[model samples]
Target: MDKRSLTQLTERFRESEKRTEILRQELAAAIRQAAADDVPQKDICEATGYTRQQIRRIVLAGETETAAQP
Candidate 1:
């Protein structure tokens, strides 16, 4: 590809990556909130298509964050 085309493609890829990261953080936050609110983990997994272990990790991370707060 030409230099201009390559630069445009690179910009698009960067934007896409940023969006992917934002969505991932948002999803993780949502999952953590639901778990904190006593929503069933299995239901969250089924709805979000994530494994139980992954959900557990996310919940644990949130717990750790709260414990560290002043």
Candidate 2:
């Protein structure tokens, strides 16, 4: 591939990564809310395809990020 094409592709990949990060944060927030609403952790895991440990970490991270907000 040409240098210009590679550069454009790299930019597009970075943009996609940024978008994915935003969506991931949104998902983490929703997961935290689900946990708080008395939803079963196993159910959440099944629905989200995340292990219990991962879910816990995501929730913790989400809480920390939220608490850091002004």
Q: Which number leads on TM-score?
A: 1
TM-score of 1: 0.89
List candidate 2 segments past 4 Å from native: 65-70
Encode model 2's per-residue lDDT on 4-69: one tens digit a residue: 999999999999999999999888889999999989999999999999999999888878888999
Q: Would you list the clashing residue pairs of candidate 2?
A: none
Off by over 4 Å in 1: none
Judged by whole-model lDDT over C-alpha atoms, candidate 1 comes out at 0.94
lDDT by residue for model 1 over 1-70, one digit each (tens)?
A: 9999999999999999999999998999999989878999889999999999999998898888989999
User: What lDDT would each prediction earn against the true structure?
Assistant: 0.94, 0.94
